[model samples]
Target: MTPTVIIQLFVFLLAGFVGFQTITRIPPLLHTPLMAATNAISGISLVASLVLAGSNQGLFSTILGTIAVGCATANVVGGFLITDRMLAMFKPAKLEAKESVA
Candidate 1:
């Protein structure tokens, strides 16, 4: 691989490791808000992936971009789902009924 590719790979791996460690250290009670924030960031990544996929780059880049788009989309959707579920646990049944009736 080229020097640039090697550097990019190292950066990606480092970021992944740091992110994993950071997230794992957070308290469980804070996960919902963190997930919400991460969802927004993932949405930004989705847009970037879209741009890369549409840029008419070579086959390899296009494939990687497409995969990135899929991964980002899944992350955004899953984050929201998990956040919603976590928030739901804190809601009283009466409040849910009241909201549903409105």
Candidate 2:
């Protein structure tokens, strides 16, 4: 592989490690807020992926961009679902019952 490719791979791996460590260190109480913030970041990534996928790049780039779009879309949706579930845990039972009835 080229030097540029090697450098890019190294940076990606480093970023992944740092992100994983940072996320793992957060307390349970803060996870909901952090997840909400990450969802916004994921939304931005989804938009960027959309642009990349729509651009008239080479076939390989188009395929990779499409994959990125799919992954980012899933991340955004999953994040919201998890966040909603987390928030649900904090709701009063009476409020939940009223919402369910309505």
Query: How would you encode candidate 1's per-residue C-alpha lDDT over 15-67 as one tens digit per residue?
Result: 99999999989999888888888888999999999999988889988999999
Error of 2 at 15 (Å): 2.9
Per-prediction CA RMSD (Å): 2.9, 2.0
> lDDT scores for all predictions?
0.93, 0.95
Angstrom error at residue 94, model 2? 0.6
Query: What stretches of model 1 exceed 4 Å from their correct place?
Result: 1-17, 98-102
So what's the TM-score on candidate 1?
A: 0.74
Regions of model 2 farther than 4 Å from truth: 1-10
* TM agreement with the true structure for every prediction: 0.74, 0.83
Backbone clashes in candidate 2 total 0
Which structure among the candidates has the greatest TM-score? 2
Query: Distance from true position, residue 52, model 2, in Å?
Result: 0.7
Model 2 lDDT at residue 72? 100
Best by lDDT: 2
